[model samples]
Each structure stands twice: as structure tokens, then as C-alpha cells.
Target chain A: MPLPAKAFQRWLHGIAPDTSMADVCRLSQVKRTTLAQQLVRGKVAEATVVSISRAFNVSPVTSLAYFEVYRDLAGPLVPPTRQELVSQIATVDLLRAVIARTAPEEGGGGAEESTARPAESWELSPVPHATSVKNWVDAIDDGELRHRVSAATGIAPQNYSAQLTANRLAPEVAIATSRAAGVGLAGGLVATGLITEAEAGWAAGARRAALDGLSDGELTALAGDRLQTLGKALRRQEHDQEQTEKIWENLG
Target chain B: MIEILQWTTLVACAAATLSRIPNLVRKKNRSLFYIFALMTVATLLSIKAPYLAIDGMLGNTNVANLLLRFIIFGAIYFLGMRIAKGFGDVHGLQFIRGRAGTVVLGLISLALLILFALMDSEGSSVGMMDVYAKDERNRLLVEYYGAAGRAYPAYVCLAILPAMLRAAGSTLPAMLRISALLLAVGGIAITLSLLFPVIPPALGYLTFIINYTAILCFVFGLMLIWLAKAMARRKVPEHIRKPAGT
Candidate 1:
């Protein structure tokens, strides 16, 4: 869509709300140079617009229409309601729970060589799906699949998969993966329509652990809701990333 | 199983023939390396086949089996040096570095191959004409040799991986290094499994799975490399922006 005026104001106002223009830029899935050019030219791919809008929680149309968001104009929003706060706190607590299992104890020691040689010790953990996940993550990291991830997440058309697959979308790929995956976003951010299944699963697992005390009904309902939300966010992020990649491809 | 062997033979011939195509079409020495690489890969490809296990059905040893066995051992040495040089050169290798480096590498690679070959030798069909001499000691010796058979590659990788990583410019190289590391570890695990084989052989079979661990390491390592490549392309920009953002 041609960048709309209301979309622009909403986009401008979107990012400045939480953090700054710089943060918005940082959060943008597109490279900084490309984003800057998009600002200068008043043109950006739909995917970049999606990412930029999502980053600042702006309306996508406004994000495309407007050039930038400044932090000074942003204001503090109210805290979440009680129910929302409880879910978020539980999610954070879930993340913290993982630390107990992986980290070393005081004085820094782990099991030394046992009677058995530590042969292929890495695989002893035997995660059935880790192989596939690791492979996907690796492929994605290769930057050969950013747009692919976007497409898979349903953010853009499958045809758009080529932009990232061709190795064109460079710079802040971590952000692309993180944003596209919605690695750190709360359940709400996950709900925004741009998170991948793998990412959502990880979030769900972490969230589940933290909210361990929740009733079965609450947990089940929350899981379904969170999963749905995460799927949407992953799709959105993928689409945004796809758009940013297109901008780069056109420039290239 | 026979199909796999046949497929392998077809691939080997194809690879050997394909190896020549590069040298023939371009009419360049560069093709010589490609030929060697394709041939080497073909050889590596063959070493991984079990029929090339002999001494037993697809298990019976043949000329191709013996040929592949020797070729694989010999080629591992040539393959490492060649592949190392290939990767090194593409990433801007200067000299052979030194004659000493070649000698040292050749020795190490040769030793490992020889070690693996020697271990394989334990499976020899050669029986003493004087049957009385072959006793329990013979049996024990065979068992011990079998125990350490798979461990050799694991140890070799462990020894070499750090050095390889140090020489690499990118995560991909380091990851290749990790593959070597996994080979060492995986082999050791397999060896351990063989040596202390659980009585039922069920647990023992589980240990054989260690060989695949090297494959897993390579899999994950490959992922890291892709990430690094992607990151490296943008690293300069990321560096530039990090300070400003901070």
C-alpha cells in the first residue's frame, strides 16, 4: 500500500512511546543504511513498514507514511491490568527458573571426567528435535533464510522468501532473527502477529515454567491464547523482515 | 544394501569422471584441485560405507573393498592438507606457511590414517597355519583392538580441532574445526562403548551411535557458521552503530 498520512502520524508516534528513534531504528529488521534511505526517500518495503510499526507499536500505514519517530515526544503509558501483570510476571519468572538448571553452583564446578569417557558428551542430552531446530536456526542465521523465515512465519508471500535466501539482507541479522522470532517480547508482543512457532514454543515453555502454579484451566487457556498470539507476531515479523529485504534487493 | 554399494560405485565413477570434467573443460590447473577434491570426497564417501567392512555378507571383502579401504586411509592425509590449503587460500593463505608446517601436518595426518589402518588390520583374515598357536591371547588382542578401533578418529579430531580453529578467519572454519572435534569425541565414545560393551550388546549398540555425534556436531557447527557469515557481512555496520546507540 502507498504510505497513508494517518499511518505516518501513528508510525511516528508509535516508537517514541516506549523508547527512542534510535531504538526504533535498532529494532527495525532492515539495515540502518537502508532504513535511513527509506526515511530519506519516503519509501520502504511493506515488510520494513511492518517491522518499524511493530517495533514502536505504530500503525503500519502511518509507519510507511512517516519518516521517523523521536523519543522526546513519547510518553509513559499506564501499567498493565492485574491479570495481564500476573501473566507477564509469570513469564519472567519462568525464564528465571531455567537458570537453576544450567548454571554452575557457587565456587564454579561441574562434573569432571567420569568412569566413562566424555565421548560425544554433547549428544548425550539427546534432544530429538534439537537437530532440526539447530539446522533451521543455522540456516536462518546464514542470512540465506531471513525472508524464508518471514514467509514461513506467514508475514509475507512465499515468493518473497528469496530476498533473505539470496543473502541480500545484511546488518543486524540477529535482530531480524530475534524480532522475527519474537524472542524477548512479552506474550502481548507475541500476540502481535510476527512470532515463529519455534520461538513461540520456546516462549511458551519458559512461560509455563514460570507460571507453574497456575491452575490447569488457566494454563491450558493461556497456552492456546499465547500460542495463537505468538503465531500472529511471528507472521508479522516475517512479513516485516521480508519487506525490509525487498528494499535491500531493489537497492542492490 | 547392495543398492547402496552400487550407488556408491556409480557415484565414485561419476565423481572421478566429474573430477576430470573440471580439468578438461576449463583446461586449467585449478581443475586439478577440483579433481583431487572430488576424488578425495569420493574416497571419504566410500570410507563411510559398511560393505567396505568385509570379513563377514555385503560383509565379504572384495578388490573394491580393499582398494577403497587403502584409498580412504591414504586420502585422509591428502584430503586434509588439500582441503586445508583450499580453505586457507580462499581466505588468503600466504605461503604453504612453511615446509615444517607441511611436514608436521603430513606426519599427523599420516599417523592418524596409519593408526586407523592398523586398527582395521586387526580384522585381517590371516590365520596362523599352526592353529595351536592361536589361543585366548589372540582373542583378547582382537577384542582390545576392536575396542579402540572407533576411538582413533575421535582422538585425532580432538588433537587437531583447536589448531584448525586458530587458523580460521570465520565461524564456518571454526565449525569445520568443531566437526573434527566431534569426530574425535564421537570416536572416543564409540571406543568406550566397545571396550566396556554392556553384556547384552543392547547398550553396546547404543554406544555405536557416537559416530553420528560427529555428524550432529557438524550439523550444529554448520548453523553457527551460517550465522557468522550473515553476521560478518553486517559486522562493520553493527560495530559502527553500537557505539552511537549506546
Candidate 2:
């Protein structure tokens, strides 16, 4: 049997059995009537949810996610707009680009590859194959692909297929799918005109030389471990650059 | 000893003038260049030989005295405005931005010039060395000239002192901070000289010493500020470092 739609309410009741709804309102600093209406509708504001979570001594993100799951179970959520969907996909594409740029070569022989070929020969291919988001998603045939993508992206498995079908996959979902399927979805998105040329250019430029010797499977496997390291390094570089500029401005 | 001190001051003024030439050639910070140029001319006039030479050229009517008084006072006023503007640029203070403050200063300078001219007479000499030895009536006029002349430059210096101190305390580079400190010291020195009431027999020599020391400090401070900026531009950011073992 499927789990009850009121899982969040049930959890709330279990944790705060003796605490009245008025007590929750008082603790959260939300109005009694508003809390009651939100509880009934299975929808809570993030601030109110965080406050309630604090009152119950629960993790705020976990509590918020529970509420989101409960709200979806209670009613079908409205789909995101097309523009939002595209933006989400672009963000995923950007993440993937970062991954591809930092990923090591397939044979672990990056130095060797450079030595074997002239530096200019490693420039990105001018006419790489183009594929759309729909075409890329359709190519994957595994029954558990939705689950894998959901696990990676944190989107519900049930919604993955629908989102993929409607071209509404969030960036995280796209990144997860890219990891699972062993392909760069961002490149495909760029090719299909979903991601603009300007948006994709930086990623392409950064990764082109690094990725020259790597095959499809190697890039996908590399994405899982390199994400945090590259993200941190990029942020550190940006911070250092900012500090240098500030020092120069002060000297002036 | 006083003549040697005067010559040292003249040398310092000449050095300041030479230092500003590169800045002028680069077309950078023209206001600062003009300040140095004015200071040089003022310093030249303050020396006995140049003052007497110019006095002789003007048929000993003391017009050079009037002209030198105006130039020195005007230079100090302009220096104050420039410092105020520099402080404004660094700290975003609105009161120091425009020409209105400088115009007000100019008017005050003009008034001082007129006062000095009205005090000048057949017996009343203008330069510090000759002014003290005149008759009782002439001495009163010379005292007026002396007080006004010292007080105006002192006022300009004291007015800009707080801003220089603030700049010294701010996040400006070490050289600029040092520059500001030097300027503040110069301002304080000039102000102290003005505040002293007793006219020592060595008053002329003392004034020349104080004025030159202040100008040298200010000039050195400005040079450090420029040097700091140049060094900062030449520094490379750490992120642009080459790959390890490259």
C-alpha cells in the first residue's frame, strides 16, 4: 500500500504530541489562524517551517523537504514555466561543464597525450555532433534510469519521467542524468539551441583542452568525485582575485 | 647660517620643481604639478637676493613684495583645495568637491593682498629682515604684514590637517599613509610657527627654516604616494601564477 499523504502532519503530531497548535504559533511567531490554514493545506512557508523545526528540534532542511513531499502528496503541484525549466537546465549544463573541464583523461595519461600531440591539435573540434535534450533523454532505455536520476538530482523518481517528457527537467536532474547516462547533456543542450552560445562558451573553452584526450565514459565517472573539489577551487580563485584588486585599489 | 638655510630651502624648492616635471610630462595629476610650480616661485621670492633684485627692478616701490605675498598666499590656498579634493575623492566627502570653496579662499587671499598693499609705505619695508628695524609707525604696518602673511598660510595648512590625518588612518597604501603623516606634521609645524607671538630677533631666519622644512616634508610625502601607486601597478596577482614545475 502507498504511504499516507499526511506523512508530514503525522510526523509533526508524533514529535509534538503535548504541544498545542497555539503553542506552535507562539513559538514560530506565526499567527494561529495562518498556521492552522497551512497545516490543513499541507503548505508551510520556509521561515515558519524552520521555526517549527527548531521548536521540534528537527533539521530544518529535512523538515522542509518532508513538508514539500507532503504537499505534493496532498495535491498535484503546478508545473514550472518553460523559461524556468530552461534556466534550470542551463544551470545543470554549467555544472556539467565545470565537471568536464576538471575531469582527468580516460587512460590517466594527460601528460602523455599532450606530449604525443601538438598543443594546437587539442583545440575543441569545430563541428562536434549536436543533439537536443528530448533526443538525449529518449536514447536512455534503463528501467531504473528515473530512480538513478532522482537519486542524483533529489527530484522524485515518479516526476522524473514526466519532467523529462515535458522538457522540464531541473538542472540537478539534468546533472544526475548526465552522470548516470555517461554523456555531457550540456553540450547537447547547447547544440539544440536550448542553452545559448554565450552561456556554453566559457565551459566549452575551459574544458576543451582538458577533455581532448578523454572519452565519454571517463568524463561521466570523473564527475562524481571532482564536483566539490573544482567548485571550491573556482570559488577560492575568485576570492583571491577579488582581494588582489582590492589591494591595488587601496594602493591607488 | 641663515643664508645657508635660505639656500637649502631654495635647493629643496628646486628639487620639488624638478620632481613634478615627470608628472607633468606624463600629463598625470596636473593640479599637484601646478602646486609645486607655485611653491617654487614663492620660495624663490622669499630669498633675500631675489626679493632685493626684484625690488630693484620695480624701482624699490616694493611691488615684488606685494606680488610675492599674493603668490605665496595663493599657492597655500590652492594646496589646501587640492588636499581637500584628494580627501573627497578617497572618502566620498561632498563638501570638498567643487570650485566654490576655492573661490572663497581666493577672495580671502585677495583681501589679504589689499591689506598688505595698504600697509606698505615709504618707511614700512615688506621683507621679514627689514620690517623689524623700521620707525614706530612703520613697525605697526610691518607687524600687520607679518601677522597676515604668516596667519594665511598657517590657516590653509591647519584647515587641511584633519583630512590628512584621516587619510593617514584610512586603508590607503603604506606610502600614502606615510605621506599623509608627513603632511600633517608639516601643517602642525607651520601652525605652531604662526601661533608664537614673540618676534625673536632671529624671526626672519626662523620663518625661512620652518617654511622650507614643511615644504620638503610635503614634497617627499607626495613623491611616496606616486611611488606606491607605481609599485602597486607593477605587482602581479597570485592567481596568474604558472603551473607548478613550469
Candidate 3:
């Protein structure tokens, strides 16, 4: 995925063929010896590429996109993935969820809280839930879809769980999940926020309407599942932050 | 060749110490400044010309060599304490500054003084061990002194190695991680240097090479951390200023 030494040379020639390496180093602020060593090794370092981008009047991201691994970053308007959406939920919203779960009930056996409200603006968007990718995958799954998707994608169960926690699925894994669930092939892409529901050919308001149409029990179960995972993640994060704080206090 | 390496190492240690003078004068991180200063003096005293010159001023008895050993102990102690506290390594800190650490350091210092006193008082010489090796009884006393001088540093280095390795793998700044790695290498080199006397005479060429290389690594490692701090205080230079992007 890295731009090879030859390709980097080609790029340099394309930009300013007449310039000497010394001049390039002067402009880019890269060390001449380091650049020469990298060239000798048939690779160009990322820092060298970044410095070259500045010298050549190109954005670092645009220059970085020349590498295959960074091609996804070159797109003008790539949407945030489902994991990003889940991670971006407001603190107040998270607190509300926690409070709702533990609040005293006026009457015994009351209906779930989610069924009491209509779909809100954030929920009715083309990309629907603020919940993690894991919860969405679990909700759409029939009994064996997760296992089948994992087998097809060649991602181990633990790795799959980790990806879900991060709210991400590889594009192929997303497609495999949809295939295993017997849904539209692009459903996984839409669920992962790789593509909008509109791009996936969903009718206006259909995605929101589908979410609104789920039964109270199903909604409650999904909410419970998402909150449980989120609580564990939050606690682990808090513990780690405490340790980092101690290190900083002693050293920094 | 050994003399050349020793002088080269002294120059480098001097440079590293000199580079930190601004910080030292401002009373910032005085412990680090002291570490570099002590190490510089130790390096100076280890070299032949400076050792002979200074020993002549101090009553012509090679006590400068003993002073060099004590300075080395001070340098290693400060370096170990800094690494242990910076990494929040409780075990390393306890082993270094705790009761057991004090006892070990005291014992080593006592042993070094006793061995030096027992050796026949002689005219000044830079390489005391090499000079005393001509006489069997003085050779034994010098050998014991050398072992005593190395014992505390080896102990401190052993205690700090785990902390250094952990810091190398941690999410600290890149320069700090690299410094930790260099310190670990220096510690291992020092340990190997201690064992060099046990190796066959044919492999003796490695003695000064390993010793000097360990000194250079330690100096460069500390210098890197100092440079990183200095750079962090400065604004990005205009020449490499990143172009605004979409």
C-alpha cells in the first residue's frame, strides 16, 4: 500500500523534474541523508512524503492518497462510520439512558420507555440508530447470521466482536452479514454508514418507518443490549483513564 | 585505540552536559542536569590526560580515580530514580531508594573505600588497575575495588531495566520511548562490560568498545529527551509550515 521508491521518484519528476535533491530538501525541510537512505532501501518514509507534499503545494491527505491504503481518505464526502456515530452520542443522551433504566416505575410492569416516544429527528435520519454496530448487527440477525458472516469473512469471533465494539465492519464483512441475513446486499453498507439509505435505494422515510414499526418488546431488547455493552465499555475506559492520569501526574 | 575511544566518549558526555546548561541555570529539572554533570565529570576523570592532571593537584595519589567511581555512582542513582519516578514504577523506585537499596549502596561504598585504603599507597597513575596488576597483592586489592565500584551501578541498572523496557513500549512521546530503549541497551552493555574480565584474553578487545559504546548510548539517549523538550517549546518553523488543506 506504500508508494514504492520508484513511484515516489516518478511523483517527484512529475512535479518538478528540474529540481535537485538538495533544493527539494531545502524546500521540504527533509534531511538529505535520510531521503537518500530511504531511496536506497526502495521505500519512502511517510514523514518524507508529508514534507514533499508541502514543498509541492499539495495537501498532505491528497499526497497520502497516492498510497493504496490511504485511497479511502481521498473521497470528498465519506460519511462517518456507524462506530463513529455511536461514539459521538452526547453525554446527556447517555446519562438519560442510564437514568431511564434505573428510575422508579409509577406502576408495576409498565411498558418500555422507547415505545413511549415517536422517532426523534436524529433517529429518523437516513442513517438510523445511534447504537453501536454490534447492536444493529444483533437486531437484524436471525439465529445464525453472525457465525455465518464470521465464517464467510474469515474474521475470528473475537476480532468480529472487537470490530463491533468499535462500530466498524470491513466492507466485505458488511456485505457478508447482509448476505447471511438474507437482506439487501447493500444493507450492511447502509448499516455501517458507508452509504446512505437513499444511495442504497430505500424510499423516502422508509428506513425511519421500519425502525418505528418494530414491536415494543423488540425495541426494549435492542435498547437493553446496546446499553449493557456501552456500560462495560465506559467502565473500562474510566479505569484506563485513571491509570493514564496517575502516570501523567507522576511524570508530566 | 582505547584511549581514543575514552576521549571521544568524554567529549560526547561533555557536549550533552553543556547542552543542558540553560535548563540547569534556570533550576528546571535540576536532577537531570545533575545527572548529566556528574556523568561528564566521571567521563573526564576516566580519561588519562585529565585524570593525571587532576590527580597531581589532589596530592598525587590517584584519588581522582576514586572520585570518578563515586561520581559514576551518583550519576546512575539519579538516572535510576528519574526513570523509576517518571514511569510510576513503584517496585523499581522501592528497590532504588528504599531501605534495601540504601544498605546495598552503603556496603558497596564501604567496600570500595576499604579496598582502596588497603592497597599500597602509590604515586599517581590514571590506569590504577593496569599499574597495580604488576604486583600480586596490589592486583588483588585493585580487583576487589573494581568489583566494589561496579556492584551498585549493576544493581541499580538491574532494578531499572524492567521499568525502562516498559516505558519503551508505553504511549509516552516518541523521543521518550526511544530514550527508554537506549537506556535499556546501555544497561545491558554495562552488565556485559562487568563480565568481560571473565572472558578469554583473545576477546579482550571488546572491553573498551562495549564500555565506551554504553557511555555514548546513555549520553545520546538523555540528549534526545532534552532535544525533544526544547523542540516542544518552539513554534513550527515557517519553512515547513503545513499548507492549509480541505
Candidate 4:
């Protein structure tokens, strides 16, 4: 399932039905003038590549690979068929179902953790305990949890723990954690080849919601498939920009 | 005054430079590590004079040189790739190879060249050796760029453009990116103030306040990351790094 270049673009384009380049530009660190020149030239040249490279904290080689992936809509190579996309969707759904079932929260096992609570905290790696950090945080409704997390992850804003306590987990915090753990989870199921950018986006959105302090319903609202996919693209753009800035800092 | 900091910085530089090579040379998908290697070298080179002489050491010039050569160039490289995707939603630029074909690359080179020229300019130079010699805290770049429009590229690259990107979207994710970018810009401003000094910067007191605050946070973050990695590698005694894990 090696992602062909076209599939990558299709997937990139596919995230959030009709994601605009303007959105990407807003998310990326590349200057508007530089972006203009590239548009006029019709291809990312050395300058763009270098800019992207510096921007993302990656080398030109990696940037070029991404360039090929993102180069226009037609895709540099054969893309997945419609059926393939559908199948990917179906697979994701199946996993979600299994996750829901095991977690005891989604469909059948609602309120399974109503009577239970961890003594302090524990990170479960192997168990399918039918509960998510979001659910746990939501149920507990405490900022101490955010403090605990901050103590663990080294992010800030004093009341993050309080927000977790207050059932007000910040969206950004959720997204960051989700990115860290969600990608790992998805990698377990779908190989990079079989997964389209859209699916990846969804997983990211889901994870962001989980970390974000939003209730499941709220997450679902924000992450309705198309919007979630778009969010993913925007997130990727943001990540790219952060990476670019880091690259520049290193250079500076 | 700077002797202790200089030596400490040099040692850290040497350690960073040496720690990265094995990973860099390894043939198996060596990118993240390679970037680190080059970055260390660049940092070391930029700060090399600090290790040797207090007086003749590269001050603000090195910082500007590194920014144009490293940071700005890297941004252009990746932006090129994304723009290559020809679509209506974006500018839909075609991808071209070679230095001559890439206008952005041309501009970056030109910027660096101009920066070097600026470095040689009368105001850009070391006009007050005595003042710096007295305290070494009086940096020049900050004094210059902090003014209305001196560090034009730095502002655009470091501050204004990122702000615009942030404005284009109002998502929480955008907020985080904007925050990080803002802090980085602040970092640049402080570093400029410290190393590549401008004669008169914008609210030196304010700049000092923000710079130190942001930098302390950055350093603390770095320390924590290092500590976490050390603990993961069992370099940190289990008893101290993670009492809970026990």
C-alpha cells in the first residue's frame, strides 16, 4: 500500500472536502510573496524547497519528497480507487467499533467507569478498558489532572489541570496529545500506504478531541467527517509551520 | 564577565557537535539526526568566537548570517514543495529544480549577501567597543531591529508573517502555532539584543524583560526534555527522575 504521489495529493486534497491553498498558506510559514512567485512559476522550485526545508526542520531531501506528494491535484502517480477509499473508511469504522466496544463507553458499555476510579493515575498500554483519557478527565472534572498532565508533558497555562477538573480541557492540549498518541495508534492498524491523508486527519481529530477536554458529543460536532478532515489538513499545516520555525531557530 | 558563559557554551557546543555524528553517518533514513548535526555545527560556528576571544568574537553579524543562511532557506525549501501542487485553492506553483530556476532561492541568497554588506556597514559594525568591553551586555542587533524598520526581514520572517498566518485562521491549533512563533520571534529579538546589537532598540527594558522570560522558559523546556530522555535512557537515577514510576 505504498502511497503513490498522486494518492498523497488526493489525500491531501481530500482532507476536508475542497481545502483551499489559502488555508494552507495561512498555516504555513512561507511568505505570501514567496508563495506568489511559486504560483507564477507553477512549480515549487529550489527556493520553495529550501524554504520548506528550513521551515519544517527537515532537510531538502525530505522536503522534496513532500513536494512530490503535494505537487498539484493530479498526483504524481496512480492514486487509490474510490473503492479503496471506501474500504479504508470501512476499516476505520470497524476499528472505531472495536474501540467503542472495548472502552464500554461508545455504544454498549456506557458509564462502565461510573463507579470506578484510579487510585492516582496509570497509563494503560495493553488493556481495552473501554475508557479514554477524555472520558476519565471529563468524569473527574478537575484542573489537577491538567496539572498532572503538565507535570508529565511540560506544557503550561496554570489551570490546565483545573480545566481538566472543570471539564474544560483546552482544544490545543488535546490536539498535541492526540498527535503524539493517535498517530501511534493508527500506525498499529493502517500502514502508511493503505491510509489516506483523510483517515489520518480523522484519527488526529479524534485524538485532538480526546485531549481537547471536549465531551464526546462536542468532539463529534467539531469533527464531523469533512470538518475533521479539514482540521487535519490545517493541523498538518500548523505542524509544518512549527517545524519550519524550529528549523529557522536552529539556523539562527 | 562572559568568560564563564563562553566556556560553558563552548563545552556544550562541542558535546552537541560530537554526540550527533554516528546518527548522521548511518545510512538508514538519516534526516532528523543529520539536521541536528548541521545545526550544531552552524551554532558552534556562529558562536565559535565566544569560545576563543571575548573581543573579536562574532557578535550580531553571526546571528544574521545564520538566520538568512539556515532559517530562511529552510522555510523556502518546503514551501516550494507545497506550492508545486497546482490548484485553485492555492497559488498552484509548478516545481522547478536548480538555483537559477528558483526565484525564492535567488532572493534568499541575495538577502544573505545584503546582510553581509549590512554587517560591513558603519552602523552595523562595532562602533562602541569600549561600551561592550565594559559590560558585554550591550548587544547591537536588538538596538537596530527593534526600531521602526531596521531588521525588516527579521521582523517579517520572525514576527509579522507568523502573525498574519495566525490571523488567517482562528482555530485553537492556530493559536498554539502563533504562540510558539511569537515566542520564537521574541527569542530572536533577545538574541539580537544580546549578540547582534542595534545601537538603540525598542524599549530595551521591555525587550530584556520579554527576552529573558521567554529564554528561561525555553531553557527550562530543554532541560526537562533532556531530563526525560536521560531518564528514558536510564541516565537519570530512577529514584530521582521519576519517583512515581517506582
Each model's iRMS = 15.2, 10.4, 9.6, 13.7
| Second chain TM-score for model 1 | 0.39
In angstroms, the error of model 4 at A135 is 6.8
Considering TM-score, which of the candidate structures 2 and 4 is the better prediction for this target? 2
Q: Which candidate comes out best when scored by TM-score?
A: 3
DockQ of all models, two decimals each: 0.01, 0.02, 0.08, 0.02
Clashes of 1: 20
Query: Per-candidate TM vs. native?
Result: 0.31, 0.45, 0.61, 0.30
Where does candidate 1 chain B have its weakest 10-residue lDDT segment?
A: B237-246
TM-score of 1: 0.31
Cα DockQ of the candidate 3 complex: 0.08
lDDT of 4 at B15: 57
Q: List the candidate 2 regions with Cα displacement exceeding 4 Å.
A: A1-252, B89-107, B120-128, B202-205, B237-246
Native interface contacts retained, candidate 4: 0.00
Q: Over all chains combined, what TM-score does candidate 4 have?
A: 0.30
How would you encode candidate 2's per-residue C-alpha lDDT over B1-246 as one tens digit per residue?
Answer: 867766776787678668768867877666677777887787777777787777777777666767777787767766666665555533322322245445645655666566656653443233744554656655676666666667667767766787788768755546767888988888887887774457476664666577677877777776676676677667763454211211
Docking class of 4: incorrect
- C-alpha positional error of residue B157 in candidate 2 after TM-score superposition, expressed in Å: 2.0
lDDT of 1 by residue, B1-246 (tens): 434443554454455445445446765434334434444443343343533343343333232333443443343333333333433333212222245445544554455445444333322242211221346654454444333333333333433444445434222334444533543343344334444534465564343245334333333332343344455457563312111111
Q: Please name the candidate that would achieve the greatest lDDT relative to the true structure.
A: 3
Tell me the chain A TM-score of model 2. 0.27
lDDT of 1 by residue, A1-252 (tens): 224344544655656656565666787655777766666676544456667666655554333324432121122222222232234332222223323223444122333222123441221111112112222233224354456556544546333333333323221232344345433322222222233223223332332333444444564555455445446645655653443233122111
